[model samples]
Target chain A: MLLLSRHLDQAPNYRADVQHFLFGREFRAEDLPFSEKLIRAHVKNGFISLRPGIMPLNENIFDLLGIRKKWLCARCGNRDQEAFAFCSCARCGKKCVYCRHCLNMGIVRSCTQLVTWQGPEPGFDRAFLDGRPLCKWDGVLSNEQQAAATAMKRTLAARESFLMWAVTGSGKTEIMYPAIEGQLRQGHHVALATPRTDVVRELLPRLRAAFPDVPISGLYGGSEEENLRAPLVISTAHQLIRYAGRFDCVFIDEVDAFPFHFDPMLEYAVHKAAKPGTPFAYLSATPPSELKNRFLSGSLKGVKLARRYHGHPLPIPRFRWIGSWQKLVQRGKLPSVLHEWLKNKMEAQQQVFVFVPSVSTAAALTELLQRNGFSRSAGVHSEDPLRHQKVADFRSGKLRLLVTTTILERGVTIANVQVGVVGADDPIFDEAALVQISGRVGRSAAYPNGDVVFFHNGKTLSMVRAVRHMVQMNQEGDR
Target chain B: MERCLFCGEMRGDPLSFHNLFSPEYAPGFCLSCREQLVPIDPRHCCRLCGRDLSRLDRNRVTEGTCSDCVKWANSGRNGLYVNNHALYHYNPFLKEMINQFKFRGDVRLADGFAAELTRAYRRIVHNCVREQSGILKRKPSFLLVPVPLSSERLLERGFNQADVLARQIGAPIVQALVRVRDEAKQSKKNRAERMRLRATPFQLNEKAAVSLSGHKILLIDDIYTTGATMRLAAEALAPARPDSIRSLTLIHG
Candidate 1:
């Protein structure tokens, strides 16, 4: 193998091996396992290209005036001067600046070199393109879903970005099946990227089951699978930082979710992960105003599905005044109104989702509920180490109630589950979050109706806007 | 426009006359991040290890000395080594900060503690001057000797955290020791195992040992947990016949 790598001009398979790893991914020189000689041979052969990992910030008129110096991270496109720091580098033996924003991925210093392949694309396994359907899922989509799916397929084939403005529980994942199958049959690489790890975990099994014959790899923070050559990849947006121009078609699920909506780095990752002019499909219940304005102006092709797959109206949140719930919980007492509502749900043998404004409130309320004979309840926050186990136990009906923060407001579905938002007046539950929290109920067709109550000390505009938003969606669904 | 090195928030230091007239102010941390670092008060700390005696149980602290220091003193391992002066108490926040600096390769975080390390080093020098009154007419300078790591470990971690921290003290650093054995991390060992005197993992560099013949050596490390590592390091420097040995650590667990 060493001899073959050394004589790269004579060894055809050796060049293919380099291309296989570097095809669409941008990797640091140290991250690649190959020796420098072989990589240099590839570079000499015009099969590989290298660029500095960090570059000077684009020169403006002020920069020409010699005002200040700035740098940009080529990997994550971070131009924030605050996110860069200089240190005495051990590798370069000089003062090196690195981007701290994407430091968790890998340290990209000014002296580091990023390598990418400029060679011909490797051929994918086209055995599945023998006129047989790729999707094996037997479930049928609703008429609205079918229409939106068709529009997505058409727009994506035309190489145009499309947005699926669908409500929660609108079978958004199922709508992408046809488009994904179309992409896969043509031997094109497709990816489903989401903001949160929970959403990726939730979508992985469903996507795998739908396309059993295709090789699927799921990427997350600590995921064990590292196979990047798979044609269909499901990963969190953070994992896409290492990829460049990889996917021919990318579907961003939950485009307006936390960290993704507020962080521009994830957006840059998605853009870098896809080939230029590659079509993007954005699926969201509540897109940020930028995308909404673009869609409303008809500049972007899209479809809106107001109705859910179950054809049931979304459970509009009903506001109930509960005086100072935080003080009550702190005083080791559940609010009377919320207590009565939970008791009624418990007596009816229904599981409950008690959403709190913060982790401390969730912990206190979980303990208070357990003390009040709700012994099977548990609290889960983003920092909880046993969060996965607790969520699994709740899903399996081993736990009667789950008290959670906004971490579980989306991408979680439990049948016949009723929601009670403690301190809904808190600023943490914005209009988008409240809609997502209420959308958690009435998800399954078996139990198409569940109660959603906002137990608040005082009604805020967000609460009113959330209710109004759901009511308008319901009106549109009726039409 | 300066941002906190830890939390990335604006430092927001008011433009007072002192700050305006002072030499270029180094960006350190935000007020909230800085408040999390619980500094060990010199008056209320164990005299030997500089640990906060107020936080320890009364039974464990007797006459301004912690029980661990008492045990060390009785063990007769203090050849020419003195005590350790730690800057802060080992809280979870500092533990995380150290983890980032020492393990995650965020070497820039060392700049955040430059002022504190310099202040602690100055206090040590001042105390040394007061102890040896007229024999040392001027402030005696100590050579900074950061605890060395094995070559394998240094390659793995990219940089020695102690060396980075020692550089911030603005003192002449002497590489007088090299780690001969790649032992397991001191953090993974229990207190009893660490306290048990065993073969030292350090060896004196013959080239640098000649310069350390009579100078005061101050060993720098991220944390002084059991003081066993410090004692073992000092024992390694015994062959050099240094006049005295002391340590300055960022935390006392």
Candidate 2:
């Protein structure tokens, strides 16, 4: 048998009868590199031997790098990968073989994870749209939804790009019907995306009625719309992560919301999901500071609908003092003044929304309201599995006076809702949240105006600012 | 002088490190080699059942993939090439030769494995080497991976069984991933759940992760049973940007 000490460019035929064999050791201060010792072991095995007169069989450092036992390329005997290209193996379907260019593209073959896509989905209906929704058109166009519809129709017909920075209840959904129809007529795809599920459930029925002919896919977790091979995709931002450059046009509804704003991965996912040079239009009422800076810097496009189509002035919520909500709830009591106000609203056949600071507050107040003759009130929080159903119950008028935390503060709509905050001074009820909570009232066109009463122990700057902000948004709308 | 043990296959060349480690010289042999020389070859036994090829049912599922994988080839939708590298079938002399080297610590038995592997060739090895060379004739990127040992087992054994062969093969070995899960030894678990849990745990850290991206991974192990370990590791690596993957084993357990 032959033994080859791994001295590259050494004279060949270096064979000797073995007296003793010794492997490299950690015992001494300087052990040879791990790769060199492995090459020596290979030299130790007859698996390879020095061909006489040749400088061993190969001369590549990576081959002798001791990383893999068979470091030699099965194709060529090149030492470094930069010298080769890569392509898929024709014989073997899953394997990638290197030619020359492959070495440079970082061709690492990973074990493939095989997932079976269940195939294309079926249910989609888009027929005659009801009154082609035109929202936030001209301030006096009370019936000018047709104009809003016209503008949207023109945008989709030409694939014209635009943003919709309309405030809450400015009828963002109503404005989309014509755009969706345009996509159906033009044979293109359009997607409306919002991060909130409450909004999805609220919009599904409306979309079903509007686009009764074209197929529409409502995408979110637990949705089996795998085969959304349709013209419309309404999806949450997180679901966009799996796709790579698929959608033609992406409309980001509530693009300024939490995970989309806070997570870079979600942003990367969205970027990857869209086609090259495709238009991404965002609809946000209250955008983040970054968005405002970008918009001001002329880095992004901006559009706005400043007035509520209902034309009624945005309600000003007045703040009054109440000591401690926990104390108020202990005796199954309702604040005398607040109770009288709710009683008057109920007598007038209007709905009241009692917005509490926490789920605990909602539960305590729901019981207290029931005990004090407001027996129709029910507490709603995310912890309830039937939360969606309960909200539906409220919308259907099966329940009245819904007491809730921030869960129903956005994404849900109810007509003639008079919103009241139990502890408006608490910082948990920040300016943005306060505005959304207040916006809950007077959403639908049926009742254009509703009262907003905010009760607190002390007047907070947030409360003052939220009311000012609501009035300013309304004024901006009226502009 | 240890009778200049196991060096018979070297064209009777004078002893050297090559001959010392070569199965030809310090050829690893079973204790029975003193009586009869056993043979070794590329494994023909089912990687799943480890059943002898003569006993293959042709209808058996072979657990995870051995059956379906072969059938799915070229269909385009979902398929993989080749069944597995672990189909150890050799003559009596080769088996005796390998068992002695492995069990008796006749570390030089690598030559016997190499020789028997070369023998089972029937011209296939040279043709494969030629064809592979035609494509990857350049600096061949081999992600030579030592079969991972559970941290506990690796610490206890002080060496990986797979590394022993990789050393003899003269290839680069990546110790990039570790099996965090202490999967019950393969002999015990047969279900896919065990495979999923075990497969995902073989995760890559930063360096292994970097090197793994777009690499040609050669999953080196000592045995293949149910191919659970190999398949799991391959699946885990599939997302890491490896260009392709194949496994090489010293013997089928």
Candidate 3:
């Protein structure tokens, strides 16, 4: 009887530890540190809930229609039938379905139980919310930036979604500082998510410097720092799939970038990561049509800043016809027109960015340039193991001409770098992508104007639209 | 509407009478992903090890067998074990696929290789029937015995990769062997060290020994590197009096 009383007394301590680890996260039951008996007791006491990792989509439908059955992954919100496969499970000793989409995170099989905390919310240390200024950024925001930042703060404080429809190089990251600071001042967790890893890498250092005393965690594919309880999380959207109802305010930068716009699973991840009724701040140069339409109809509150932080108009691209460049590249010769343009840039001692449509093109072009006396040129792509080192070399002027694919089109800022697009008419370079590629030039105030040339084999509608988009934005900046 | 299991692109299979009339199978991979896999050509492979002979050096090949098989034959370790038949070359692409399947614990990737494994198993059965003409007039029925991992290793990897591959053959499996010693991974050992290692890590399962009498055993595994593992496993099964032992693997590195 005495031992039973002591065990009962220790129950609250175990429950508190479980609550602390699982308060705002969804984890596989096997991943939890506690024993099965403890977890079961907590589940029975209404302090935690258990759910199947993968569930059948249509349990009530009969098999007479000859339709294939589908399953859903509760963790990643994956409903694609192809992403699920059946195997004889080792743990359950039965045929079980597992989600292949998020397999890298962990194998989520049908028998796998997902655990989440359901009891009263755990208390957090609110000592940081002493009402001092959190953002230490001393740089002044331009008039347009100031106006948009103020509007963002107001809408978020009212618990409403806000979009910053700003152009590239328009101080988008700086404008987010005030809003993020407001959330952190209230001891609320904030997450700044982007679709691309390059953007996350670029924002981590800037955000860390702006708020030096705050603990921040930057998450990407192979990032080693995994402080889940950090108040500020800067992560790629893919990493947010592991979190659940953790953030009070979520900021999505580059809202229409790749994978996020192409794959609905990432959108589901961001939605699942934030608490219910959490406000979202979207910052984008070229917003997708759905968000654009909502903002235009006045159903969603947003502000459009056409002007860049430097108060200069966007660089308009010039088109040049280069016939059959692929054949010339295969023949180990550079296009005559492109050769002359590169020669001019090199003679003026300016760095250049030559963007190709595919990885193979980047390699072949880099070799062709090197054989023709441009020894300082190099190529980089997403799969290159030395991608970070190569980009660093380019920034430090170790490589004068950087040959790259679309992976370098965003989140890179180099002063006075001239941009060249090889095969710009390819379908890969859509209007939004072309605009972002052109935005790479003239990013710094010291070199506020640079050349952007689109060398194409034939004119494409996307090219025309991209040019028009820039022209319209420049006109808006003038007004 | 079918998509590649690896790349997520449309399979885009060309329309043909063979595809339209035949019962459809689940899509494995798209054309590009399929093209990356290099199958071993039977005409140009080492007769014993089933390794692609074209990539081997001229001096390494004596008649039809590679140097490694000659070394194995000279060791006198092939008690009742026959030669191994490998389906594919261990190129970087297959290595990456296997890494994802084995180390990363993505067991679903085994589905992509189901058709290839089934076809290879049928070819092995046909060869066995042809070789043992008088001893086995009819096609021989074989039992699959996947190479076993130590208990600790099994718990760490969640599932045995050989067991997953063996299930694709649709053959009856018998757990007749258990690993007695947990050695370091075979991939980490040098060729000389692997060949010099004398002690066998496997032992016959006493409970399943009765079922193995007079049965033709085909040991299944993901890769056949030095052939030492197969010989050790065959030696372990000698106590059960199996009729014969041969091996099948996905790749011969």
Candidate 4:
């Protein structure tokens, strides 16, 4: 497992302690038996953590936990009959391996249960989705998105899991509407889970408008809807801590964001919240090639919606290198070119957000900007007490210019704002941050175009690649 | 032979030295015979000062945790534990008698700890219990409550480790000290990371803390760590501005 760690093929911050099941008992790789097929299977699954080896408990799980078997399959009379077959796994190539029948769960097995919470709610209805309906977009769906929706609708009709590989502005949200609407129509509960609170807030009104008569609640940390009695619920992924499979349609928006991208529990939460025959649709701009490869192998159903909602042009980013900011700052000065850009914008009454590599640098730059007679600028970092207030001020124009770290990059948007990234060449700034930060610009159609400047002294590959990717996604939409 | 102090069994878990097993000169033990291990009453011990309550070499029984703890009579967790209101001597009485109560499934030992604590708190608890008691001794500044077992542990044990002891002292106990980051169970962590781990993991209850503004605090915990837990707890409760935070632990080791 450390061999994988050595590759450092993933992000540098990705620390998978392969040593976790490492000591304690002499269990080691090459010691246990996983057929090449099993290893290949999990490798293809992408998120597996040498998982099968961690049996957690091996005895008759009921016998191990000493839990009573409270559930009996109400179907065919065989007491030991297996649960539903993958029948046809829309993921993993399945000939029809049914889940162990007696597991036709939702039955409380308190006696043999080792874990406190039994995952996967047994009888969740579509009514849960009624609480927070799918968002409403007051525009026509692009033909690509319409086609994608029709396909998703058909897959749900057949009970298959699908992956949606739509570009950032490709109206993936609208395509999700049909699936959510179908589940609501079936009277099954629906849950739309995303990785960001900003997106959840953005969708609250949209979903409320789309499913006007249904009960809906936005679920996130500090959210008001813990007593989720609705048919639809919109929640950030982490909020699912209180939930498990209790919904018929689980829409995982932005399936590739932090924590959610790496956390195994989230996958567990999604599976637990989804009912039998429920469909999971991963909505994302970049379909981490691992998932895309799975689709190509015919294991997962892939649908591409290469169209934006308003068909609005994606704001393409152009890069400028303003290298080694620490050296420049050490001289008690701002790089003149970047200084000129900021001065020009402020003079024009335009609002601007500057992204820095780290919190310390963000503070330093905020001080610099404020000292330069841009006194209205304020720093936004996790350590700051009034972060949400600062964001609100930026939005209301109470703050003419705001200096922030990457915290506002992905999830926050201030309307009609131009973007600048100080020291974008710093290794900390990467493809995802750049794309999401650039995305901060050109939010609305009338104000759809905005400039993204990577104020770096030397350009990094991630910068060039991020800009190229944005252009590619936008160009792909044109066709 | 030393009689089993707990369960009054014939066998016990301690080795008997000439005076060690004797019930008289030893300040009471015969741990095996009593069916209850009473923590050996510490002697020559300074009560106001929680040091060598026993004249015995303290070093022989427990190793000093760090240079700081080794040199000082107590880690002196800030001024919070200036008096170090520690109760048990960590003797056969604590090991056997308390475990019998704590794990053999009777919560009565906690109450007994409380009773003994009341004996310790004769001056403080009495005022709190008296008529119009609250208005009586300035209401103990504000309360710097103890860190609790995570929710998982709470469900398993049915109660908090610090709550029972805190409630016994008649001190206003608050459950506001929260474990924000569910740290991996640190039972086995070493000193340094354990110290760093404490910082990122703890937080104060917002409402209880704000209310504590300008008040004195009684920080309570069931057991003391390398003093890392207490130090971190104090930081988490910052901006609440407790006039002075004092710590109380049932056991020091």
- For DockQ, the strongest prediction is 3
Error in Å for residue A122 of model 2: 16
**lDDT (Cα, 0-100) at B146 in candidate 3:** 97
Q: Compose the digit string of candidate 1's lDDT tens values, residues B71-155.
A: 8999999888898999999999998888767766787788889999999999999998888856537788899999998988886
How do the residues A81-143 of candidate 1 rate in per-residue lDDT, one tens digit apiece?
878877777666778888888776667888889999888898777666678788999999988
Which portions of model 4 show Cα errors greater than 4 Å? A1-138, A296-298, A330-332, B1-253
Residue pairs with backbone overlap in model 3: none
Model 3's C-alpha root-mean-square deviation from the true structure amounts to 3.2
Predicted candidate 2 versus true structure: per-residue lDDT over B1-253, tens digit per residue: 1322343222334557875785634343333343353223335454433335554465654443346344333233221213346435344554555544443333334543554433332233342456563455545456677767677765433345566666665556787667778766665665565434332558764467778777667777766654566666766666677766667665554
The regions of model 1 sitting more than 4 angstroms off are A1-18, A35-41, B1-4, B9-26, B30-80, B89-92, B134-137, B148-158, B174-214, B225-242
TM-score of 3: 0.91
User: What's the C-alpha lDDT at position A388 in model 4?
Assistant: 80
lDDT of 1 at B89: 97
lDDT of 2 by residue, A1-479 (tens): 13455454354332221100111000111122224454344455432222211012235676576553322232122333322222232222433323221122122221111111111222233342344542222333445444655665565455555566667777777676656655555445566777777666667667766656556678776677543445677777666544444556777777766556655546655665666776666666666667667767766655556666676656677777776756767766788767888899899988888888888888888888888888777989868887877788888998889888877777777888888888888787877788778777777788877888898888899898888888887786666
lDDT of 3 by residue, B41-77 (tens): 9889998888999999999999999999998888888
DockQ of 4: 0.02
**Chain B TM-score list for all models:** 0.96, 0.61, 0.94, 0.62
Per-model tally of clashing residue pairs: 0, 82, 0, 60
Task: Work out the TM-score per prediction.
Answer: 0.89, 0.48, 0.91, 0.53
